[model samples]
Target: MTWVKLFLGSLAVSLSLVATAASMPDGCNCFCVIAGRNTTVDGSVMLAHNEDDSGEMMLNMYAVPRLNGNNAYLWGEFPGTSVCDHFLNEWGVAIASDGCPSREDREDVTDGGVLYEVRLTVAQRAHSAREAVKIIGHLVETRGYQASGRTYVIADPHEGWICSVVKGRHWVAKRIADDEVMALPNNYIIDEVNLADTLNCYGARDVETYARERGWYDPERDGRFSFKKAYCDPYYYTYEHNVIRQLCAQQYLTGRNDLVPDPDTLPFAVRPNRKIGLADLMQIMQCHGENSEHKFVYKRERPWNHPVGICTDVTVLSAIFQLRADRPREVGCVMWVCAGRPCTEHYIPWYLGISRTPDCWRRYASAAQAVKDHFTAVEHKRDQWPHHIYWKGVDRWASYATDWHNGIAAVQQARDKRQAKACKAFAKMDKKLQKYYDPRTLQVKDREAMVKSINAFTEKLYR
Candidate 1:
């Protein structure tokens, strides 16, 4: 059966067929159902719509992940309350006053056989009931029921916030940098190649081309698009966030047995023709890096533990892989990928463009919490180095870098006439390092010598 017919049929069984058609918003996402679809092997059909005055973008039939659940919906607006510090599991657009509810068995309002509802809210009266139905109806038709996933839209001078669609689904609501706030940045320009495609990776020149067209990178700058600039854009980063978040949530929801109906019952459909798995998702999450390959090398040239770099392509592949085979153990490993080091702090501020790093985010919590868990896994094993060797080497190296950075900061602070006692202490330390160690270059000339000194301690201890 055709997916469009199947979806309409499903709705017919739950609601008045005429009502279903009449109730649908003019332009909202649709969730198509088809036979032999909704598995990694067979695949499912998707109908998504982007409703903006600028354009109405819609995808009629695209293969969607199996774990997306049995019911689908088309939704564009979300209504809820904001609960700061509330822990939401799935990444979607929604507002709640408290974090994700601890209970997963909450009731859902039904429409067209699908389950949904307004779980929490602040200004419920301000948001019209008709709009709520339209939003829910639109969502159900498109994405199906994402357990904790939601998308929100707001009105007026305060624009909506775009959350990070990566590991945590946190907000991406900040203005980039001061310079780029009103200008187009490197990633915004529509070019010969569609930037929204999950699989597209253009070379620096193509990136430069896009930036130049957008006025983000002018060759006149020394950084050559490397330096950060500001530009106000609603579409570029918005699409990036939404696409990645939906894909990642799908990967997790469909792949893990933890989410299955029963321990014995298989939850998702799979496609036999493809290779999809956790490793693939890991690669996808790191797709933003400059590496030609999607692979994230931790021990190589630029070993960034890029938790945020993972993208939609990676998430889609993972969802497909997990649907094909139900692996609870593998899910645990995927959890490790999020919460473990060097996954947490490695990508913060640098890759995320986040100005503030929350203390909770920096510290590791639980493997189940995914990328936020950092304490459990140590990237560098202490046993790998001799006991005293690591201590002496690391401590000395830290002291050196601290002294250098402090020296620079001190000079700048002094020039600004904002010197404090702490700055003076660091300044004094910097002078000592300069006198003892050459200030010509900041790096230690012979790290090997330091290692040799530590090795002597190890030899003596063992001998």
Candidate 2:
């Protein structure tokens, strides 16, 4: 016997890599970044995200008040995870996304498609970011993209867009140019296209003849058809975990020593080497690829056998937003959250002219019972998460990612002494609520003292 058939083919390739790493899916390891408004330092068209989902999820927030006629916005809920919800509206626009997994395994959809109404129909009907990339290419070319592709990014207060959806009715979009800087992962970082450049691209008009009738493109051995190299999903888009988190967010936004991790020599947007902010998008969304030789093994019950960072260990939440247009688009559209893993918490900020977001950060009292309990992937309960702030950031990020090098310098010295006292109480609460509003009809000139001074400085930075 040929050595008992090589020990039963090495025990059936170690039980099919432990049944494909225990059937991986706590929502595709998300990450995103955008900059644009002249590449940041507060001219603000910035965007940032990292909502890496994992089990027992529940983190909601709603201010959603323009019911059925849509757009009153400020929802972030993640109930039943249809593309891990996020938004911001009242015409400052804003949205977030990252799970890009396309190479369309053709569901060619009609109805069970359009996962969670494509960023809530571009935050209830776009107000800009070029009408949210034409409402995500007309809801993925008329109700098509159900899943296995998504990108979104969309912004306002002077533009920023990304929109890379594909899983059926093809898509593409791009526009981060007011002096560039984009970083994204979870795949599809939109590559070369021009639906004849209608002011910097938009999607599908047979998107390269349907990727050359599904041979996934071959413009003579693929010379120019680059929708992320012919519609990504090349085994998780050539993973080294989305190429070392988009080369650790363009080497922390361009201090770049010749960036690598070669997804065809990366650069779907760059220009930084200076002016980016919100503490460099919260230190590159609390990066862990810190000078990569690779070794931050945050497995958290086998989150795809480790090695995926731009902060992981199921980065429950982390945002940045900050979409300013030099003043009152209702208090310059802030977001800056963290309810966990911005390297173990502390971000807080909120404000898009708040009117309520501190009933211990809510949990479904109606947005139609949280979109009828969305896709129902329930877990979050344990006595309603010890009265909430997203379960104290999922209990201090499951004890600081279970020993992230001896508790990351005491969670970055108590999250940098509460991010320098909540950014000096948000610059004295934006100079005392921009004199109770009227920086040209952002209206509020004393709407109950600007919603009681933004609900008492967002409940005094969530206590």
Candidate 3:
């Protein structure tokens, strides 16, 4: 089924679907905050993501080994998939993506490449944001992008890049200005491509030629070739949900009340009025367009007219990558991940240096085990299955929050308190660990102990 249909159908059954569907939801949302060295509270670059998927799936983490002396990285992985949806390497490079459906003329049905493989290759090999962009362009040019178009957000400690892929072998990537912040809501955000600006723009050699041949662009009539206008699916471009989500994100980031919700004129990236911080990015990720016309209501009677919020029933995980170039590689990358709905769940910090993932965040040992745990068998009576502890905890909160009438505010407040406490505890622990030991030299046992402690603390917070 098409993503649009899947998204709408999921919304219709959102309240009724149980925690058994392991598939990712149709559409996703994400953003990146590129804080020039001075545009942040602590002068640190930050990238935040809301990985909206079929809320039923199990979320897992893996520590990918370094390849030929390349940096090792930690990424969120699923049971049956090879793609790393969200990842951070030892070099402080982070990558996240949202699927962007393309117009029929721009679809690349011949490309034998998968979207996840592109993301994984870039995450594993690229050392910087710009390099990641070039890698994506090269992959598409040679292997072809097989899936629907997608927008990838790649960032390092200094800057961010948005690489949007069209079907087949054409793509374009643009760098987010050092002082700008960008929010992507499952649609192409690059308006125009500047081939001459090698420092900031990268694209296939036939990007414009292909569009012109297809009658999607005209040099004489159209001032310049727009990647989004030429490639984006018309339905997605005019869809109210996409437009509202983009506008809401832009308004929140710029703090502008007068801006209108028009996709054609929306800036690809904007400079924030003040330095952006981790907390600000977190709040934006959780935004539901509340108290505004674009607010997303979860009532069965109300049709799905707006974009899903940061805490939708379909969101499996949300993460923020805190990368600091000032710190050593061992202590520089921190991924704050919330395994369930962002509204009721607290983000727990996982250091990039950690060698092991707690059992609660690990995937099932085998496919049989996965089926038994999530589908066929019911070992835990109260939760209906013997899923991982993390999932059990998520289900507990979701039961209440999904009610929407009485449980939202209370869950939101409690989650906020828990997250704040966890953040503070993480800061203290990270400081202590970095002060005495280099993460690179830490023994496996030491890493395991740290992970256990953090996992234990997370369980306590939920309890």
For every candidate, C-alpha RMSD to the true structure in Å? 25.4, 22.3, 7.5
After best superposition, candidate 3 residue 175: deviation in angstroms? Answer: 0.9
Q: Each prediction's Cα lDDT score?
A: 0.22, 0.74, 0.66
Off by over 4 Å in 1: 1-273, 290-308, 311-337, 340-463
Best by lDDT: 2
List model 2 lDDT by residue over 1-463, tens digit each.
2222222333322222211111235334778888888888778897888888656676788767676666788888876555777798888888888877776776876544455566776787678878878877876676577567777888887988888888778888888898988888878878888878889888888898878988889889978878888888787687777877788788778877777787877888888888877988898888878765543343245623223478777778888888898777767888878876787677878888786777777765666566555544355464754676677767666665555677578768988998989999998999988887777766667777787778788887776
TM-score, cand. 2: 0.33
Report the C-alpha lDDT of model 1 over 389-458, residue by residue, as the tens digit. 2234234323433343345344334423421332343234334333322334333444444334323322
* Model 3 poorest ten-residue lDDT run: 1-10
Itemize residue pairs with steric clashes in candidate 2.
none
Model 1 scores a TM of 0.20
